[model samples]
Target: MKKDITIPVITDVYVAVVNEYNDIYKTQDWNAYIINDKDVDLDMVIIVTDGYSEKKMTSVFRKKLDVLPKKSYAKIELMQEDLFALNNRFKVSFFEGNTMYDKTYVFRKNTINLKALQNIPLMEAKGVLVK
Candidate 1:
């Protein structure tokens, strides 16, 4: 079988429990059967931006997750629409470095696992690159 080629980009990926509103939870209490169950369906992975400040971003990101539902899955996916929106929201000015800001891309949970979590790779090419 031929191995697929993957291009790397700038972004961080994480696995967490997601709710119907697309909220993410990293705490133990928020843990749901679907996330813990190996047989459950893998939904979408949310790719959040690094933000201007890591400390502030962490708090904001956590708050974003807190708003999500705890018992359901969010239908949010990293698609063209989301990409465009993210691109506009994350500007170069958002960061201290002189880097161009591209919307973060996240994989659907089905494509990720423990091993995958060890290293979350970013997509290099422009636009949404789904596996």
Candidate 2:
């Protein structure tokens, strides 16, 4: 009898690049060039609405990145299912008088890829992260 071996396949999932801006300026103007792309830039002062946890985390992450030193960039990659799992985790109450939604997403250590934002970067031209 021959035994069949099963191999787990790893695939490149979705990726997001975040950027944050200081409250002193308007984000729209600074982000005019990158908003259309999957990449995002946010201001220090972020507005939050009800039932919008996903958007909130996304905003906070961007803001944090914006405050980082110039020429910095971060990349996050996660499987579609893992991303949604995180979303569900944040939906539940995990803090005193607050939920994960109220806080920035706790990115797993080493999961974020940081690098210098090059002039006319590849991501800027492609408008997408290619694995």
lDDT values for all models: 0.25, 0.26
| TM-score against native, each model | 0.21, 0.19
Write the residue-wise lDDT of candidate 1 on 15-126 in tens digits: 3322212245433121111111122222222324322222232212311122223233332223222222222111111111333223333343233222322311221111
Query: Which one is best on lDDT?
Result: 2
Considering only N, C-alpha and C atoms within 3 Å, which residue pairs clash in candidate 1? none
lDDT of 2 by residue, 106-127 (tens): 3332232324222334234222
User: Residue 89 in model 2: shift from native, Å?
Assistant: 12
Off by more than 4 A, model 2: 1-5, 20-25, 28-131
